[model samples]
Target: MNKLFRCCGALALGLALAAGGALGAPTPAGFVRAQGTQFTLDGKPYRYVGANYWYGGLLATQGPAGKARLATELDFLKQHGVANLRVMVGAEGLSNGYQYRVLQPLQPTQGQFDERIMAGLDYLLAELGKRQMKAVLHFTNTWEWSGGLGQYLEWNGYTGQPLPKNPGYSWDKYRAYIAQFYTCTPCQDAVATYIRYVLARTNSLTHKKYVNDPAIMAWEIINEPRPMLPAATPAFEAWMKQTAALVKSIDPNHLLTTGSEGDIATDNDMAVYERLHADPHIDYLTIHIWPKNWGWFRDTATAKGFPAVLARTTAYVNKHAAEAQKLGKPLVVEEFGLPRDGQTFTPAATTALRDQYCGALFGMAKGNTPASRVIAGYNFWAFGGAARPVPGQVFWKPGDAYMGDPGGEEQGLNSVFDADQSTWAVIDQYSKTIR
Candidate 1:
């Protein structure tokens, strides 16, 4: 917090100090600090039940109706006790019929950005700050969504490859193609440039530089940055250290994290997650879980019941929590989601299993962390809010409503919408405890 205050401009610092109340410092009121293993704001312990509202940048920037929808959703979440959001900072380039592009692409080309989208992000940040809600700003991705590594690869003469959406190729081949992203010099330079651009941005509306903005709890290096395993760990870890240190050098105010999905690429070794995030610049740890993807839960194996999934998921939380204790940093299950019972895609789908899963996940964190403070709160995979999927709804269309799910995935496959009363009940109940 002191480091952050020292970086603020003298005029803003002086004014903030003059208006101080209980905090009694020049630090921005919303500045979050790592107090041992938990996060603190104004020196008071702060925990939260956040959601992945990754579509916020797209929705909030829409013409009038889009803005209204964003406002409604933000207001609703705040009123309902949803206190945190993990949103996108920007992507690599312009849209090109990509599966899950955010509504507005932040960058239209390498080293080129869209000012309107940047302003839209500025507006979103200012509004989130107004609600006293916090956000994690994730910049890039290992996936192709939002023109990620594929775009980086695309700019470097790698084209016409079988994307993840192609039925002809296996998922492994698609991931391998993306993993090659680590080897491209131009790709590496593009990400480094994008990081600098974002770090130095001065919000047009708030007149605040992004690094100094209090609404940001942390800067997530990328959404699930992956390495081509075995041979890739050393390189990936080096990239992480470089990227995290770059963010730290540019902006000393907020926290930094490697937005990695623990074990997703490393064959389920928790040590890999810890080692990848071993850098001191990485202030906290994060992991994501997809019950179905991980094969922990099978919709057709209902006869076997939920114990296998429940036990595995609970163990994951405990395993990571214990690792976090050793590292002595706060940890967050930043992403996890289960399909609704019956695995239906309809908006009316019920979430009995999802509710139970979420309850157990939240319970795992709350129960084990009181003394250790290593288990920071969870941010469920996604929140769809009031938006519905586009008609036919197989995948996203360019003009469809931004429902917080990423590009290319089936719409609302894991969204917790406004009408999911029971799900909301569980989320609200847990969120109240965080507050």
Candidate 2:
């Protein structure tokens, strides 16, 4: 438990009193709190090795089979020292009829929600609370896989529908269109309504209000929200601040974060990243690293390219850690992962390169370096427990099981499965070091 939670609360009252000025009371006994540059649970530093189990809530909505799978996965994660889970509260706009989107979205229409999906999330939180684990719930997404900002744009009568996987639209076209979400009044309001509904909800299973649940560690503004253009920075920053303030106004106990991919999401400008996180309401800083997506690694030369990839990752994380230190906030590498060796998207493939990369990155979190010290935790790309990828399937089909990768990516890519013993060994070694 100490290895999983990383909390030292022997002198809890003194620590809580000292830190209480910045964070007021009624936070509940075990809720995670942000103090200066660290996370605290019961007034002790709370750092962790977590997983991004984004589909947990949706899976829990699947009745008996889904609930059983969710239970097994939660137990597996807890046994392996995973104490925090980063999950989507729910997806949006599935009713848009997109060919590729989150099935059974919690909010399928403007100003309306599906009660079943909401109850699924309630069950998931109740389960997490049962295990004494924490969760970071993402309100919505910026990308198309989950019917996020683009869907909002479409709902608001914006021109050019989101075409993430469509052949007719280019990636730039999709980005430019969705970037308007920062300035879209109705779209923003629609999301605000969704946020309020989720925050004010009471769990049917636990009978605890969502705002008062200690199982939830924080609330993320959106998943990977990017400015997309330099000119859009002001609007993007404004949106972040406004949204952060809005979340704090309703729920002051839980921490708030921007699900940013560091400078990459900020038009590759660190200044923009720092400025956005400097907001008083934004409690912590988060950054994601994607070597393959960022052009640092390639499958053809996996062995040779790995060194450069690790070097670049170190530099990127160190840069963000330094900035986070200056801002006086704890930093979390909330998302980062490498594909299997040779870029194979199958559970049977070797994970040597992936394990090596993950091990080195995890080592940095507990290393003696100043930058490493600033990092509070890491949630790897995903956990795909008991979910087998369909044979010969590249992209997800309707009936396929959920993996670490979303609908937008290859099914098994970057997923750490229950059978991946080598990867779990790497995770286990580091998981024991944080506390």
Candidate 3:
């Protein structure tokens, strides 16, 4: 057994002390404390310099290889002052039905317990602890494997196939299934158990002590949760309220954020924050955006400027940030990135877009715009991995293929890493001022 698992009895004592005397105290040794919406390391302000982690597949499967790769990646991140990692909890790659066959020994079915996945997480947490790196633990995915995609499809009465233009195939069934997924007894129990496991294993009382360790920053409820149909807003809001409460019940000290995807002020996205921000249990508000999808900027090769996109995106961010500030919380950009492949833009255009987009966004958040101090931090969509070739298209695949093809066209965001070193010096320079 891992050293941490052997000391479960000691966890209660640790929890008592953590909740009692150390409720508002600084974390032990290298750990930091959440001061309002910001983090204080030894009483000094610490803004997160983060990257989205897309390596659950390798980590959940090939233990040794995953460890080595993660260590190297974390080392690079740490060296570059990247302090946060957003890891998925019930991602498709970690679920039993999807790419994570290796976890079958632990969690044989959706309802079964998965020791392998837990062990893998333990290993990752231990490594992060060693480096004093903070983690944003994303609990669930909006993808197909965790039954979100499948459930959404089944509820809508659509076959497991392409995206439907009109999602009204079965509005009532869709809302029921969405509610069922969140409030269902078995599902809720499983999620709560998973949260407790993470808390117990990573808490300061455990030998691993990830929660108490400086490696864990916050717990993200879901990744890009949106209503499949317009009518599902009520159910989705209720689900967020309940889930946020469930997580806070176990961990009151750590921060909490909804991994909302898309613009925040918009009707579909506003409901999530409206619920979460009003709930006293939630600690922060988060949103994700891609300029191409919102039509904020034209993706043209000749006139590739992110100024328009930055203004459009930050307008919503500014509005939400102000509202969150009034609620005494900070606004976090959970996930954002520009595509380097799969688009019609040339390599030069892609590179220009990446630099200009990142520069403009970072510039705005760094006080160049009106919403400077209201914005907290951002985690670029991805890092590492090679580009995957699209089957028949000239450009590469667009998003990160964490499980399927790590070397495929998914590495478009790798440009962010490169740009951070060279063209995007302003981001690094501005990040210093924020902390």
Candidate No. with top lDDT: 2
Residue 355 of model 2: what lDDT? 94
Task: Please provide, for model 1 over 1-435, each residue's C-alpha lDDT reduced to its tens digit, 9 standing for 90 to 100.
Answer: 234432542344344444554465455667886655667687466778889988787765778897888888899999888878998887666656555555467877777888888887888898898899889989887776777777888888877645665667677677667767677778888889998988889988899989889989999998887776567766777777788888899988898888887776577766678886778898888878777877775655632667888887767777777777788788888999987777776778778888998888777645334323576667888989887876566777777777756767788788889889999899888888655
Worst 10 residues of 3 by lDDT: 96-105
lDDT of 3 at 359: 61
Better of 1 and 2 by lDDT: 2
TM-score of each: 0.90, 0.95, 0.74
Q: Model 2 over residues 187-286: C-alpha lDDT tens digits?
A: 9999999999988899999898888899999999999979887778899888888989999999998899999999988667889898889999999999
Q: How many clashes would you count in candidate 3?
A: 7
Candidate 2 residue pairs in backbone clash: none
- For model 3 the local lDDT of residue 275 reads 64
Candidate 3 residue pairs that clash: 107-114, 202-210, 202-211, 387-408, 387-409, 388-408, 388-409
lDDT of 3 by residue, 275-363 (tens): 66668777777877766655665554324545566666667667776666666666677676665533532223345455566666566
Number of clashing residue pairs, candidate 1: 4
